[model samples]
Target chain A: MTPALAVRGATKRFGAVLALDGVDLAVFPGEVLALLGDNGAGKSTLIKCISGVHRLDSGSIEMGGVAVTMGSPAAARALGIETVYQDLALFDNLDPVANFYAGREIAGPRWLPRGLRLLRRRDMSRATGELLTRLQVGIADPHATVGLMSGGQRQAIAVARAAAFASKVVILDEPTAALGLRESRRVLDLILRLREEGHAVIVISHAMDHVIEIADRAAVLRRGRKVGEMRPTPDNRQAIVSLIVGGDS
Target chain B: MTTGQAERAAPLSPATGTGRTRLAALAQRHGAALVLVLVVLLGSLTFGSSFTGAGNLGAIALDASYLLLVATGMTFVILSGGIDLSVGSVLALSGVLAAYGSRWGTAGAVLLPLAVCGLIGLVNGLLIGRARLAPFVVTLATLLFARGLAFAVTQEGNQVYIIPADLALTRIGQANVLGVGVPVLIALAVFVAAGVVLNRTRFGLRVFAAGNGDGHAAELMGLPVARIRVRVYVLSSLLAGLAGVLIAAQTTSGLPTLGEGRELEAIAAVVIGGTLLTGGAGSLGGTLAGVLLLKVIQNLINQVGTLSSAYQQVVSGTFLVLVVLVQATLARRRRQ
Candidate 1:
């Protein structure tokens, strides 16, 4: 089967600094790929390139065996690639359903006879509820504003929005960095659930334990270059940390 | 039962506490409108003859129509996290242009100001939204420029061109529909339309998001942030210009200094109506109520016959300060 996403020889330069240097990565269907790195490890740069926030200096990206050029976030979304940034980029005043359907809205007829156009609030809310349920999110109501929710609930809403709309690949940037242990475990479980749903998940995280928990494969980056890929097995954390810190190849 | 058993049997009831919290929130949100209504009722009871009369109410509503129109547009601009200090000057300029063009007919009077004001708005939007300039500074410059143009067109404020009495232009200001003033009806229609646009459309959501943040996320969501910003300024200026046109029609002449300080009143009404100066949230309904509240206060002061009209200004200024202080406190609480 074709890989869900492939980035080969991706290079990005910002003025005099090299953010990413010839990085190669692949995410297959139904797999969680943990992108492990420290600060300045070029993890964010790679995600930006894949998510179409920035153009690659030199490289190619392929989705479902077709080469694609992502010039904007909208373009990436059109290709079934979604990114949940660290901020989660949600409107706090609006409810979960509004946040989920912020840009994407369902329109139906105004009246039965002529039916011009109107928002399908019921359908959208139902879909939002189903997505939250599938992720085991314990939301009181989909109509509740996100500001009233806990941090973990907000994170869950973000992930559910991505998983619901993302047809193939979902990139989560530090999904649990600010969360407590219990909330972090909930997010990890949600990641595994995404994998089970057949999505190619890319998790950019600094926590080794989190990277080890739900990731099927781990790619270590140091100084804008990918150094090694490790299987999700015993002794993977130490090996990945060493690779991240410029230890043995 | 034992003491421990009795303690265990009395579970905490959070539902009542939650209900109280919700009621407090609603009161906080609607406090301004409620206070305004109470003040109006109190003034009516105290003033007796003048305050509660239908004719006086009609006059107050008619007098408020222009400011209401201007404030409605101001609400949108503020909600988008921006300001338009040039609106008063635009009103004067549009008034001068309408009077000058009145010789041609009603269409000339209406279209000329709209086109010119819209162009000014477009410029303001391009400068602020596309060039990413500070809105206050940009609009301040436009304010000066528009005022200068108004004076230059009227030959340094010496000319007062009057529209012919028999022309259709006269009806815009003087005409009444079903015993209500045309300008009043127009203001009401504008408010209703704006309410729909701000609440029911995807464009409205984007406006809220843009005001709430730097709009980068809005752009990511495929919203045309720059275009929306431009459209708001254009809409604001157009509304101001329309107000100017109506005023000129009503008076049958344009006064170069007609709209001086009107921008402040418009801003006051918008803020008093509950729109945050920092942007992100507002309501057209609140703005209408705010305009009427200010007018009612002025009318009540007039009825006293002992207080100067300046007292009205003093009262409004005090109210503005208090409301802003309360809003700031509430916003801080929400953030916490």
Candidate 2:
């Protein structure tokens, strides 16, 4: 089966910083690919390249065996690749319905003039409610502005939005870093749920237990280079940690 | 900044809290209206018949009409987390253009000012949106540029273009529906339209997102963030132009200095109405009440005979500061 995303010899440089150096990674459909790396290990940079925020200086990215260049974030999204950044990029002031439909709003009837064209609020609200319920993400009111939401609730909503929209792949950047214990599990479950739904999920995390519990495979990076890949198991954690710490070097 | 994980979130109910959050939301939305209602009641009680009389109230509404237009536009700009210092100058330029264009009849009078003002707005939008210049700096430069152009056209404020009384432009200004003036009616219509556009449109959603969320995120979501920013500035400039034209027709002559310091007034109205200067959250309802509060205070003070009108500014400034304090507190709470 074709991989959902394939990165071969991905290299990126920012001045003296070798952010991603010849990193090779692949995430297959119906699987969770855990990217394990310490700080400054280029996990973020690699994901950035895949999500079209950073251009690779050398190497190519393939989606289902087709070489593609993601010139912008929109380009990647057009290819059904969505990145949920650390901030979650939610407009806190807008309600859940508004936030969910901010960029992808439904328009009014065709007869309306340009000045009169409006968003279909009822439709957006109903759809958002359904998406959240389907994902089992609980939130107060669809009409409640996100600013009023707790951090965990906000995280759940963000994840729910990604899962609902992403047809091919979803990249989550430190989604659980700021979450509490219970919130982390919620995100972990949501990630596993995504994989179960047959969408490729690439999760960047330092939480080893989470990777062990959910991810089908794990890739470790150190100093911008991919060091090792392993089936995440109870017995292989030490080996994964050693690779992340550059024990081989 | 919160670590809202499932393990921790399950006990805490995942949906945002409804009790206190609902209360805070209500306060943020209604605080301005409450203050406005209180001031009106106080004014009515203290000033008695004069304050409540049709003539005085009409004057207040008419006076607020043009300011309402400008403030409505400012609300959108501020809601998008940007400011246009050039609006006042654009108003002045449009007034002069309206007066000058009156020679060609009503269409010239209306379209000329709009065309010029729209172009000015388009330029501001391009600079701030496309060029990625600071909104403050770009609008500040345009403010000077617009003011200078107005001065040049009016010959250093010596030349005043008097509107022809028989023209349709002047007639529209002088016309009244029932007891209320046309300008007053137009302002009401504009505010209603603004409310609908802000709350019920995709454009409004984009504006809130651009202001409340990260610009990069908006772009990543495929929103034409730059285009949206540009469009708001254009909208603001067009509204300011309309206000200018209305003011000129009402005054029956162009006054180059007419709109001086008006930008601050509109901004104050928007802020007092409960819209954040940082952008993302605001409503037209708050803006309307804010304008009314200021105008009512002005009317009440003038009725006092002994009190100086400068107290109006002092009160408005105080209200603005209070609103800012509330906003800061709310922001801090949200952060925590």
Q: How close is candidate 1 to the true structure, as a TM-score?
A: 0.92
Where does candidate 2 stray beyond 4 Å?
A111-115, B1-21, B213-216, B330-336
Tens digit of lDDT per residue, candidate 2, span B171-272? 899888899999999988988787667766778767877886447667766677889999999999999999999988888777788799999999998888
lDDT accuracy of residue B302 in candidate 1? 88
Per-residue lDDT of model 1, residues A172-239, tens digit only: 99999989999988889988998998999999998888887789999988889998899856676677
Tens-place lDDT per residue, model 2, A205-248, is 88888889988999999999998899999999999999998786
Give the residue spans of candidate 1 off by over 4 A: A108-117, B1-21
lDDT, each prediction: 0.81, 0.83
Per-residue lDDT, model 1, residue A166, is 93
Task: Give the per-residue lDDT of model 1 (tens digit) for B1-336.
Answer: 111111110011001113444443444445567877898889878987678787888899888999988888898898888999999999999999999989789998889888999999999999998998999999999999999999998999888888888888797689888878888998888877776556655566556667756676666655567878997899899999989998888888877787888889999988877777877655666677678888888888888999999999999999989878877776565555
